[model samples]
Target: MSLTKEQLLDYYRKMRNIREFEETIHRENTTGEIPGFLHLYCGEEANAVGVCAHLSDDDYIASNHRGHGHCVAKGSDPRLMVMELYGRAEGLCGGKGGSMHIADLDRGSLGANGIVGAGAPLATGAALTQKVKGRDNVSVCFFGDGASNEGYVFEAMNLAVILKLPVIFYCENNGVGEGTGVDYAVGADSIADRAAAFGMPAKKIDGTDFFSVYDAMEEVVAHCRAGNGPYFVEAETVRFYGHFEGDPQKYRLKEEIDNAKLHRDCLKKFRSRVIEEGLATTEEFDSIDSDLVAAYKGYVAEAKQAAWPRPEALTEDVYITY
Candidate 1:
């Protein structure tokens, strides 16, 4: 499907938002203000924005630890996300879930999981619900290469195909899975190849290119919505930061990281493509960036002043009373 100029600009805006938000969090985390561990989604913006652009609030998505991008792409409010990171009561998840557990049911984001490979089953269950209810909506599970190696991911894939569930198993293979390289960890030729063994269609694409990811998602979404069962996508992407905040990153060389940032950055690639195709201008992109910067300033300011959850409220929302 060809994207309109407006759509192209919107994609750029979302990717830019993810980049800016992650970078801002990285800066803030250094000051010891934001509590908890943060897994920044710096270089994997295209995978989230491209895939989520094809989805709506009716569609469900389960995210992994690096999930701020998915939340932003799926239309979650960054203001509330900032507040959540700040542990403010007004934040999403009431300031309890923090970075790895931000969920907005209204937007169909099933929260980010701290446990690796946990979201696959959640999305599978959501897709099962959609099928049982006779709805056309689909569910997507965004997991990393590390999670792809987990046994439950394969179980989710086999179950989804057997039941013909409308769930897309999206894997972002960012080379390293928490300091361990994908080359040394995954025992298959590729994650997509491994997923295909479950009797579902699978494809691997250049996750760094927004257009490639978006186009492939278009086909994958159509297949699932048509009741053709599950699909798998392995996105070959990169992560700019360490596995987590404060990681020494002794596993890889500094030069390798520097080269990827300079040559394979998705934001730069998107800007160049759109401008070269005459679909967008430099000033237009610049305006969006400026607006995002100003808006983030407001979000950060409000979060700093936002209230914290009361001590007695810890028991609230922990259980349901019928």
Candidate 2:
């Protein structure tokens, strides 16, 4: 809320990038251009951008299956990301890791994991590294509400608090996990309440509101930077698409989904606030969106003709055993 106009625009650009990139991938996936399963982050832009805005290139982040947004928000190259989806050799992981495992260490992106709740431990390890080196860097773990149910999440929290490691357990609660509603999966009233048991400060905010998430994470990031150990944030968000591309989504109500899209859209909300506050015009945001869409299309075209991984390199990064 205290952000300058430039910073606000930057947030808008990042959110727009994530939304466009995921929607593009969703469209391309329908054509079978991408081979692996994709957990598109269509409606969860605010969570990723808001949190990552407070982080630096020196900070670390480990993400879940719905991770493209996290990578882009954490400063991963869009072109390289597209190439990775196409299984090109020039990809972030030489296309071997595909979408679920895209990573860029230089950017402090630990990588997206296929395993549920796995990122928490990885982030804790990174936080340990920060603690050992006495660096001010913090590690953030981005997982879904489903992953919060995983046992490792609690373990990671315990370790983080015990070691006083600087980390943040960010839970993007989209209200549905895989094909099941979160209310059916989680026993507690809210996911962030678990933080109380760990003695970590927790915040539950409107994931659809960029400012809400940004304000909460700004505090959390500052706390971690001061070596205040780990904190927990449950962003009550919504996913526009199903868990994966081609999912039937029979579990979700059509009207509910439509209502969220129409009334709870983060971009629409953000734009209205910015305009209402006299911070910027709709035309300025529109211009940024136009440029992003064009650039994304160009990236998609380039990725289509990108070089594929060599057959000889199939076993290159593999760990072989007898």
Candidate 3:
């Protein structure tokens, strides 16, 4: 489905937000202000923004360690996100979740997981809740290609299909799971083939192209929301950063990064498409860019000034009701 002018602007805004947010995190991480590890989603912006464009707060999403993009795309506040990264009292999780465990359940973001393939079960459980509640909401499970190799992901897939749950397994195959390439770790040429083996319909799209991911998601999400059980989408893309902020990236070649930036930047590809199609004007795009820069800068300033959560509260929220 082609996006309307308003939808185009929204998609562009979300993508820009993810980009600026990551860059801000990188800057803060360098200054040693951000606590714990951060897995920035610098290059793979399209997969999150595109798929999430089709969702609302009523729908749930389970995110992996590299989940800032997903959280921002799903309407979690950016200022809160920055505060969370800074371990501030104003953070979404009140500085408790830090980077990897940041979450806002009211917005339907279950949480950003620290464990590999952990999101699958949570998403499956959410789908089950929706089914039992007789709600027409779908759940999205976002994981890396590396997480796809885990037993939990496969088990979740089987359970989701068997129960005919409304879930979409979004595999952002950015070629690597940590430092190892997905080709070396997954033991499969394409993740779609694996989905097919489980009797699930899967689609593979170029993750660097927003329209490709967005358009494909429109179809797949609609199918799942219609009680067609789970659908799988494997997005082929690349990440510009290493496994972590301070990673030397010794495992990857410099040429790969250069190639992705030059030819496979998803935001660039999206901007080009909307302009070429006359769906959005260049001035509109520029205005959005300017607004995003200002907004991100403001968030960074506020987050830095915000106080960290109280030391006494560190022991809170360890159990639900016990």
lDDT of each: 0.94, 0.93, 0.90
Error of 3 at 157 (Å): 0.7
**Clash pairs detected, candidate 3:** none
- Candidate 1 displacement at residue 157 in angstroms: 0.6
Candidate 3: residue 41 Cα off by (Å): 0.6
Could you give candidate 1's per-residue lDDT for residues 156-234 as a string of tens digits? Answer: 9999999999999999999999999998999888888886578888999999999999999999999999999999999
lDDT tens digits, residue span 47-118, model 2: 999999989999999999999999999999988999999999998889899999999999999999999999
What 10-residue stretch in candidate 3 is worst by lDDT?
A: 1-10
lDDT of 3: 0.90
Report the Cα RMSD per candidate.
Answer: 1.0, 1.6, 1.3
* lDDT of the structure predicted as candidate 1: 0.94
Give per-residue lDDT, candidate 1, residue 90: 92
Name the top lDDT candidate. 1
lDDT by residue (tens digit), candidate 3, 1-322? 3457898898888998899999888987888877789899988999999888889999999999999999999999988988888888999989888889878899999989999999998999999999999888999999999999999999999999999999999999999889998878877888878998888999999998988888899999899888889999999988989888999999999998999899898888888888898888889999998998898888888888998778888888888888
Clash number by candidate, in order: 0, 0, 0
Residue 231 C-alpha lDDT in model 2: 92
| lDDT ranking of the models | 1, 2, 3
